[model samples]
Target: MAYTISDACVSCGACLDSCPVDAIKEGNPYTIEDTCIDCGSCEDTCPAGAISAG
Candidate 1:
């Protein structure tokens, strides 16, 4: 499964820099693209616990 950033995201930008594939976009809640490698890097870096496998 791929990882997704939820509404709980704080727009902290933590996950943005952690994505190796640059799949995360900045917004109220970051969005992960289909190109995501599902490496869990963003999930591990999210400070708000807003990222999860979907």
Candidate 2:
């Protein structure tokens, strides 16, 4: 499963820099591509508790 960003995201762009696979985008919730490695790095850095495994 890939990690996803929820509507609670603040779009602060913190998860973008934490993703090792470059899966995160620069939108409201940000986007995680299917190519995601499922690493929790992004989740750990999310301020809004938006990143999760799906």
Index of the highest-lDDT prediction: 1
Question: Residue 35, candidate 2: how far off, in angstroms?
Answer: 2.0
Give residue 50's lDDT in candidate 1 (0 to 100): 98
Count of clashing pairs, candidate 2: 0
- Per-candidate alpha-carbon RMSD to the true structure: 0.7, 1.0
Per-residue lDDT for 1-54 in model 1, tens only? Answer: 978788899999999899898999888777888899989989888889999998
Tell how far residue 4 is off in model 2, in angstroms. Answer: 1.3
- Model 2, range 1-54, lDDT digits (tens) per residue? 767789999899888888888988787668888767887999999888988887
Give the distance in Å from residue 52's predicted Cα in candidate 1 to where it truly belongs: 0.3
Q: Candidate 2: where are CA atoms >4 Å away?
A: none
